[model samples]
Target: MRLTPFRAFDWNLRSCGLHGHVTYRPDEEPLAERLHTSTPVGEAWRCLRCGTFALGAPAAAGPADEAPLVLRGRALRDAVILRLLAAERGIRGLLLLLLAYGIYRFDGSRQALRKTLDDYLPLLKPAAMKAGVDLEHAGPVRLIEHALTLKHSTLLLVSAGVLAYGILQLTEAVGLWLMKRWGEYVAVVGTSIFVPLEVYELVEGFTWLKVGALVVNLAAVVYLVWSKRLFGIRGGHAAFEAERHAESLLAVEHAAALA
Candidate 1:
């Protein structure tokens, strides 16, 4: 029987499994040792008898548990979006803090403020009447009056709550920007806590602003839950990792070749 000469194949072995160089020449070390040093290149080896390619050993664990390039890009995009939203929350918190400060300042001049409002009522009443609104009977007007007349203890409590909430927003922003898992949980819970309030506001009075806020919050919640695989939704982290691995270039190529 005659042996057919073997030639180097045109395809790359790196995709199959070979990480580095492979030498075919005779060397001082044994052949088995040399072959052992070369990582297995699946289905890329050639036989000396017929020059046909032969399948090698199964692939080892990959370099790292990395997702597909596209999936990584998508994660980056989502992170950017979440960070931007987090920044918006931070700004909102700051604004709320400023409002709280103003309220605290007003608490000291409640009588004077009430007098001023009462004096302006004559002017406001006419415009409100023209607009078919009753300023005297409006819920917001009553609430503002109540807030202005709050005792010192009540005012301090309200201001403290606002400051604490603003700090929470800033905390969430930092966590999300860093892509910490805990941040996602905090964001979900914090945002969800206000959903009912937002819904109530919409029910009481519809406005484009309220609708938009509700929609955005709902979108963020859904995106984080589904895409990030939070709370064991869609097989949780393990399944998410598996899905990412399946999308890798090598895996895709292997499946196509098999097909």
Candidate 2:
């Protein structure tokens, strides 16, 4: 009777021991020594050093208490999507804010420019009145002049902030779109840091729009940190280890079968 090449060869099992080599069947002598031998077949083929599978596909060996390995993949994908959406939202918000500022600063049409000045005049009045500015002559032209005189430093500071924020948001959007882990972290940390400040603004102003913005931002923070799974202190490391372990197991099994 003719035997298959694998059966006639007494294929050496690839060693998963700390020292990388192959172990032949003859080497499986003393029980203690056999335990270290890499020739075990079927479900029992495990690395002596890591207790990982030495043949076939690696068995799922994640923490017993944790969810199945399949779930981790879904969770990671969901987290990544949520992070990307959050980044997009931030970029949109920044763009809108910049657009509003641009309309106020450089709208060329006279009527539109005047309307922009008029809309903000009410907010400026209280400050101007406190400084004893006469409003009778405060038309668009004089009003703009007075605004520049009273709030030049404030406008400069706010403009600088908007520019910086726009750049940061754009960067964050690009990072998240690329599905980078660091981008996930940055989105969670940066957005969460602003929650308290937004809350403070809501408390001070108590406007419906302000309240809504605060609520939306807070919800975004919660989703990214908890549901996305990227913000977990150990999730990234655990996922990386699982990938490496799977690869190593596959390599060993392939080598053993070839041998």
Candidate 3:
């Protein structure tokens, strides 16, 4: 038989033990070959190249590798569904921001807003006092309300922006969870766009908790985009194609076996 490099085959040696050595030779050649094959106690084969019996007996026949049947079915379907869910979440986040903006525009009372300056006023008081706002006459609540109302439009815009960002984050998270390679790319690009802004915010204000939150978000974005291999657009497509081919091969094999 013609010897091919890197070719794998199953050889059956009747008398060889698990660690027996066997010789392989061209059907028409005078050269003797030795190789080792491994096998369980009763079924062993030897490699013709080496006299060592470490090589195990080869099976009569088998496929090179078994495709993961379950992953192709339930796992892949689940990934698709998750991708849809992620997209929906992003849309929802966008709607929330829009609703916040609507509330800012329609509701004159600052307290009426769902997420308002009133909520963040407590956190800002210490800063305002440090910035030389008189606490005696200007109570924290009053001061914050006045500032918020003064910049009502700006605050609304900021809220809308944050909502939009949240939506984007949701999209990326969902995409990653679902294994859509494009989701990963989009997530990385989108999140990276915000990194500088987040850094600026942290530097300007220097709130411990907010800074921590920014750092965590940044780290997550980097991990998903780089190390996870989800953002490799070409690689992802290739993986999908390979999965499809494996599925097709499995189907064909099953059909043949049934036939």
Each prediction's Cα RMSD?
14.1, 16.1, 15.5
Tell me the tens digit of each residue's lDDT in model 3 across 21-53: 332222221111122223455433323222233
Which scores greater on lDDT, model 1 or model 2? 1
TM-score of each: 0.60, 0.44, 0.41
Better of 2 and 3 by lDDT: 2
lDDT of 1 at 73: 32
Question: lDDT of candidate 1 vs native?
Answer: 0.64
Top TM-score model: 1
- In the range 117-195, model 1's lDDT, one tens digit per residue, is 7889888998999999999889888887888767899998898888777777777777777777778888888889889
lDDT of each: 0.64, 0.53, 0.52
Candidate 2 lDDT over 208-257, as tens digits, reads 99888777767766765654456343465576556545644443333344
Q: What TM-score does model 1 achieve against the real structure?
A: 0.60
